[model samples]
Target: MTSDKSFFDFISNGLPGPELRKDADNAILPARKLAFSRFRALGLPSVKTEEWRYTNIQRFLKDSFSLAQEEGTISAEQLKLTDIPQLDSYTAVLVNGRLQPALSKLPAEGKVTISKLSDAANNTQLQLWFDKHPHLQQQPFAALNAALFADGLFIEAGVNASLDKPLHIIHIYTTTGNAFIQPRHLMVLHKSATLEIIESSVGLNETAIAFVNSVTEIVLEENAELWHYNLQISEKNSRHIYHTSTVQKADSRYHHFNFTLPSAELTRNNLSVALTGSNTETNLHGLYLATDQQHVDNHTFVDHLVPNCNSNELYKGVLLDNSNGVFTGKIHVHQDAQKTNAFQQNNNLLMSEKASINSQPQLEIYADDVKCSHGFTVGRFSEESLFYLRSRGIGEEAAKTLLVNAFAFDITDQVHIPALQDFLSEKIRKYVSGAINN
Candidate 1:
């Protein structure tokens, strides 16, 4: 365990090491410097920040954390010890913030390339993508992530190729007390390529406070298809901040699934998708379960930059105990984005009187021909349904479980992968049952 230290001092001490990179693109060095400058200018965010008004990060800054290093406390074998059972796939194991290549396995037939970001940073195409979507200036954490990401995942699929198995990437935290990690992941799909990726985060124990800051960027070219899933369940006392951004070309399809368990004390998620071309189809589905004093917040944005794009988003949450949850989703249609079809909905089930959820769903349409609608709902278990279940001789605990499961069914049902759906369903069921038992 480390002593309490200031966050500014920590990041400043760590920012001077990346300028000497040799294998990376010449532009990446300058980009890192720019990102660092942006971070220094932004500094730590206060509640005054509109995007972070509800969450207070002051406490996390006050405590000292073991920032990720090349050396890890655990080995590849240790990564297998996790909450989520392993599924059949090529797995990439990341201990702390560094990629363990010895433990990672790529897909058969060499149809895909999964390697470290440093190894691929010299690629001209990847450099172009990195330069086009450089948005590290948006927030302080994002800037820090850009400047300090230790190692990242790079996946590239050829044109007209489809992967036979999904790629499962797992990130584990093993340092005691508080351990901080910042990782970067980038995926580029050529025209008509298809791929599936799953990112899972886990910690060794509940006593330590693990802090993970990760950024994932994905690009789908014309007619490409992608299914990405993020399943995060850290220590019971941890802080996690994640950002995922996607860009879809014409006739491309992108689907994203996010499942967050209640293990962490504080968690925040940012999901953004840009419809760069017409006839693009985008779908976002998320489910978060929280209990005890946990706090989880999710922010999402969908931009219809072109006309004739369609996006569908649905998020559901079950909050129990004294936990607090926040969801803010925005759907924006540009003035030129006519004939856009977008729908956004957020629903929450407050299982405890003390539990609370703040939901905000926004829709901005500048085009007359756009069909965009956004709404949110927050309520408790239906007493009518409970009564009916009780009348059928079901126990109170069992009745509550059934009602909660029914409320969460819609979100989990949207998961296209059967095994992954079952995995998420079991996690949700455990949380629901725990809330009743506690």
Candidate 2:
């Protein structure tokens, strides 16, 4: 095997061409190219690189993949397969990272405004935000997305507009061949606006090894409220990587819940939240279950850049067979961020002896008046709980399943929508049943 440094260098040097770049108000060609150069300079992160020690992308870098550009259509029949419950509300559809107008159903009348990125009349807002936040240009995968993305969905909620229905965004990855798809999403909520966004990803082909690299940027104005959900269900041979970043203003509230089920080779998710104003609140909850030889990694960062901010994070995972799971979370409170309240916890359950989990929860508090705490735990099913259930007439397999479901209920129950909560419960039940049969 080639050394990690050499491998990253090889992949970085093979950056895609900029000839067929997408047309944006302010072309990101220069920024994207500069990011590629920075990526080459940094190379693949190793154990020495504190942020990447637990989740390694070296193997993925060594693989050969091509970026997809041409729009591949998915028939209405194929789109029907992704019918999400309670989807009568506003919805946006993207196939192979390109927005599908005919496939999407938008709310006829609502405070929410949804339109195709290519057709949106908010070029001024886009340019201003992108100019002020060039950090998006520096993100490796995000830069790749900006440079290659053809079109996506752009959503904006007017000031004080309280959406009565959730907005569902479905990303369908249909494999024409072995290729990589980068999907980009931008959501902005004006002051005092309330919005809920749901995202789901699905792969069509089982044998094709496709890469799904996605990026979502959210901006919340003062006193805005946002509830976000991300659900992943991809083919066994497909790989999915995601980066989600959020910036909140004073008194804004942001809540996120992420669910990752079985997938193919590997899946990594990076989520970050920056509280740039006072009295901001943020919460993150995640659940990941992987079986077979699959690997799943979840990394989160919360930066309290101002005073009187608060954050809470909880991530749990279950690994069966020879699967692997990882969770790394960091909460940072700046010196001026006094009175910040931050808490983080990661817990995992390993079913089989071969299953493994790596968890790290960290806190960096530069403010002496802050309250921050972090802890992690990794263990198998409690024998005592299992014995108690079995003694009450439950079968061995059923007892185990019950315990696992109970452990996952904490996060699943947080889904306020009754329909969504029930759907997720059924999914968890099926997953446990399959594990027991194996």
Candidate 3:
């Protein structure tokens, strides 16, 4: 464990070398060393940094934390805290980022392979695509994660393979003391393969602070399609920074859904997609609801490198109490990407006078033939809408909940899974009711 002031010095002074991890493969050792060098060069971001101007990350690192001394354990009863009702899918359970096969119901082994990153060190896909996303190059936390991450899930779907149901990944973080945890994951879909994945998290440490930095890289081959949904609902003692990067090939489709609900002290999400091939389709949808003093930030980037690509993005936020929210979305169209159509919109509702939001939507188009647009709006909860609902005999609390849900319907309606959509609606209702009662 290191004191607050020594957090940076701890990593800088006692850096881990290849020999530290005897289990690391010779192939991955070079990549790890390179990543460590990159981290040293970039260091951590400060408030002065353009990308981090609104969020003060150093405040969260003031507390002392260990680098997760040992792997945490969880019983089946404890895992039930993260279960979503009516989600009939294969489940993969990870404790402290290490895959626990005994507690997981994995897909069949023929076409889909799911295993720990450490266990798959010698895998061909792992060697070829590990830490290869270009967007992560400039992110210091992501670079640090690449350098020191212990273990995480690795999935590879073969050509023409399709899962009968979605795959649910449950990430459980348990620590005896305050800890810093880094989890790394990679998913690859071969040509014409299709898959659906749902991710959720649970923190069991009631008294300790668990700061997690995780990275997931996805690759979609030609004609491949993938649906990804991330549900982040953790205890207030947890802080998280997640990076999800995807690379789409020709004619591929990538759809992503992100839902950030109450209680985490801090949550920052970095999502980026690189369309390297022509005729690719990308859809990004996000909804974040924060209460109390929680802070939530979402940063997204969509890059169109070739011609005839289309990308759409929509994000909605609801801030209550003294909570704060941030949204930054960027759509970039290269000169070679002619006939690209990209659109982005961010809308937020502040439920309390002290609540605030900072939104920046940007579009950088180099091709004259491209159609790109970005917009953002932030408004306080409409009293007129509340009064109209109350005039119809609805209670104050119920009226507020209805208005919030109605404002969020545009983003929630795009969810493809019926059960998941219902779960989100219920969660939104609960969050609104709790905030109003408080």
- Using lDDT, give the best candidate's number: 3
Q: What is the C-alpha RMSD of each candidate to the true structure, in Å?
A: 2.7, 2.8, 1.8
In order of appearance, the predictions have TM-scores of 0.93, 0.91, 0.96
- Candidate 2 vs candidate 3: the lDDT winner is 3
lDDT (tens digit, per residue) of candidate 1 on 1-438: 222235667776776454636534467777777787887787677677788878877656566676645355675466655534647787888777567777777666575887788788787766777634533348678778877777778888989888778888888766665667788888899999998888888766557667778888888999999988888877676688988888899999999998888778888898888898999999998888899999999999898999999999999998999999999998889899999999999999898999999888777888999888888899988899999999999988888877877887887787767888777767776777888887
Tens digit of lDDT per residue, candidate 2, span 1-438?
A: 248555554445445555544442344546555655665555445556776676666566455665545477788787876776655556788888777768887776566777766555345555545423334544455655654555666778889987667878888887767777777777889899998888888777666567787878888999999999898877687788888888899999999999998765788888888888899999899999888888998988898999999899989898898899988897888899999999998889999999998887777889999888888888888899999999999998778767877888889888877777776777777777787797
Poorest 10 consecutive residues by lDDT, candidate 1: 1-10
Task: Summarize candidate 3's per-residue lDDT along 1-438 as a digit string, tens digits.
Answer: 223336657665434555557446557777877898898788677788788888899888878778744589887788888888898999999998989999999986889899998888888888889889899998988988887888899999999998899999999999989988889999999999999999997777899999999999999999999999999988889999999999999999999999999899999999999999999999999999999999999999999999999999999999999999999898889999999999999999998999999999877889999888888898987778878899999999888888888998988888788889888888999999999899
Give the local distance difference test score of model 1.
Answer: 0.80
Of the two candidates 1 and 3, the one with more favorable TM-score, higher being better, is 3
Ranking by lDDT: 3, 1, 2
Residue 280 local lDDT, model 1: 94
**Better by lDDT, candidate 3 or 1:** 3
lDDT of model number 3: 0.89
By TM-score, the best candidate is: 3
lDDT of 2: 0.77
Q: What lDDT score is found at residue 53 in candidate 1?
A: 79
Clashing pairs in 3: none
Error of 3 at 416 (Å): 1.6
